[model samples]
Target chain A: MEIFMKHFIRAVLVLVFLILQSTFCQFIKIWDIMPNLVLAYIISLALTSDDIMYAGGFGFAAGLLWDITWGRVFGVRTLLFMYIAILAYRAGEYVYRKNISVCVIFTLVGAVITESIFFAANFILTHNASFWQSFFRTIVPSAAYTAAFQLVIYNLCLKISKMGKERSSSV
Target chain B: MNFFKSKLFIVLAIVTVIIVAFMILSAAFGFGTGPVSNGLNIITTPVQNGIYGIGKGISSFFEGIGKSGQYKGLYDESQKRVTELEAEVREIDTLKNENDRLRALLDFEEREKDKKLVAAQVAASSPDNWYAEIQLNKGTNSGIRKDNVVYTDNGLVGYVTEVGPTWCKVLTVLDINASVGCVVPRSGDTAVAEGDAELAQNSECSMNYISKDATVIVGDSVETSGLGSIYPAGILIGKISSITPELQGLYNKATIKTSVDFKSLREVVVIVG
Candidate 1:
């Protein structure tokens, strides 16, 4: 019952972030580029959670929803989100993920990996001549923008998790 | 709680994501089931649309404040064009009446246009996409189908690539994968407008295959030629921003300043057929 409650709340949080990612991100765009808030949210939760699978499940569900919502191809983001989860967990294990400095680095690196892979997929699928041009101009900047937001989102998720723990223990 | 941190959990998650992904991949590639996916879309599109509308409102708030000065020049130019177009429309209306009279005398059977314009809100666009594609609130239920032309009050946006029950995806003209049939109205020379990777990053595309002797110049308006059965004729595409100075053959090329301001673009009108 406890485990169910925890995962349930986490899933709800992930869904909220997904909604904000698709909706709010469009409005606060920097130079026609909005940061990937969903990616950041998933990565932040994974950094502290020992249950990578639950986080992975959250990511999978979120990615699948995004695919259905906006993606041109199906299952593309599922594979990519898995890669991000594995990378964030493995890298966080060795480094100081809770610290702001190292967390930003991890976020940036994770964003780069995810966005680069996505870019390559688009390039290969479309065979467009301007793939590299879009990569440097749009993809890279998007990574940076998303990394900047990871700071706030990561801390916020941790705080929420802590509060959930306190409430569950009191009950 | 500690059980979730176990190696078993990691393995379990990986397997689950992979399995689901494979199923969806197969569905996308082959052995697809449309009804299931369409059902999912029908469930979520309305909720997504509501959130998307709030997003647009917030975005408009910031953009209007920050970019008001930038739009001043565009506003003045559009006003001038509107006046000129009003006069042109009056002239065309008279000509249309005369043609109808002539056709009536000949007892010609008139054909219905078979076109419906569906107004929709822009649901969402990923920044990672650089506006390459946009999601629309209207979809197959609204008579939208794949390849339906998507445009705005200003000009051409792109084509509907994917359709759902209540939402559709549009591949914008800025995507390197997109191409449209267009022409310079002043010279009446036809050309193909294709997304250029470099220019698309800046929300522009270039026109290709103009006749070398074509009388196209800077600031000349380019519009859909309707040579292809896809888009309606004379729908405004953009203006020739710069003509390629040198040409290797009898054909010429130029860059177009797409009239659609994608950064501020929030609504679209899909031509449903």
Candidate 2:
């Protein structure tokens, strides 16, 4: 029961943060350029959580939420985020949870994977002859911006997680 | 192990439930219809308007500075062209009336020209992850509906997709989902104009389905075919920039340079029927 409650609270917090990120932060641009904060948050939680299955489930939910809100090809984000969670679990086996650099790397790599998959899906579905054009224009800039923003967001997620742990311990 | 088994099942079940629920809700109400989405759009409109206003101000300031010396000559030339166009319009009006009268005598019902034009400023643009879309200040309360054609003074811009009380979102001509039936004015070859994700460098659209033998040349005008119920006939779309003839027995394609600059769009007119 305690574990379930903890996971539930963490998932709620992540959802609230994502909504705020999408609404308040002008980090995203009209040219399809923006940071992937949700991916960062998912990676952080997935790495730190004792329950990998719950974390992966939450990540899947986050991807679906994004698909609905942003109106992108459904299931693309879900697949990308699930893979990110699995990658985070594997990375956690090697790296220390406290390492900020790992978090940044995870985010950067996740963003690249997410965008590349989206581009590939579009290419396959639309059969656009100019696949490289879409890849360069939409995928590259979006990944760059996501990586840059992840540098900041990863650290913030770390601080927030630390603060939450401290508060729970105090309580 | 039993705890893990039950926990995994529960988590997977919940995740599946959420996904199914979201898909059903989107199918019923369409995506981005939640109260939270509406509130976010409302809150962000002012910020987007400010950003657009600043960009417009900077460009106009530079343009004013650059044209300070040549303003008089440019103004004289523009005035002369306006007079010429007005005279041409008068002659065309006479011919149009004659045609209408002949059709009326043949018992043809005249097409209704009733349209309410609502001018609204762009509130917000599509987020980085999404394709081309613009939020307008007008919505359902303003009589804007889904598929109402939007335009600028220069040419056709897009169509309204979602509407709120005080705002509406436009799916621009440059979105892959949007397809406009267009025709080459010179050659009269009909084609389907689609947004070219490749030509994002120049923010252009492409017209596909032109026959290989079609006599289309660069700089020829393109206009809406009015075949689709979304857009009216005779609205200017763009000019052909380049044409690629059929290869491998496929239809030809042409790149169109749209007149309305999506990067600098401010005010747009929604033609509501």
lDDT of 1 by residue, A1-171 (tens): 656666677777766776677667767766666788888887887786776666666667777766655555677777677667766776788887778667677778888788777777666566654566666777778888988997788788777557557756888
Q: Which lDDT tens digits does candidate 2 get at residues B87-181?
A: 68668988998887677534422223355678798766654454677778777888888888898656889998877777788888888677999
Q: lDDT for every model?
A: 0.74, 0.70
State each model's TM-score restricted to chain B.
0.67, 0.72
TM-score of chain A of 2: 0.74
* TM-score: model 1 vs. ground truth: 0.77
Model 2 chain A: which ten-residue window has the lowest total lDDT? Answer: A21-30
Model 2 segments beyond 4 Å from truth?
A1-65, A72-90, A120-123, A126-133, A164-171, B1-6, B17-114
Please name the candidate that would achieve the greatest TM-score relative to the true structure: 1
Model 1 clashing residue pairs (backbone): none
lDDT of 1 by residue, B148-206 (tens): 99987578898888788787878888877677888887878899998865687567898
| Best model per DockQ | 1
Docking class of 2: incorrect
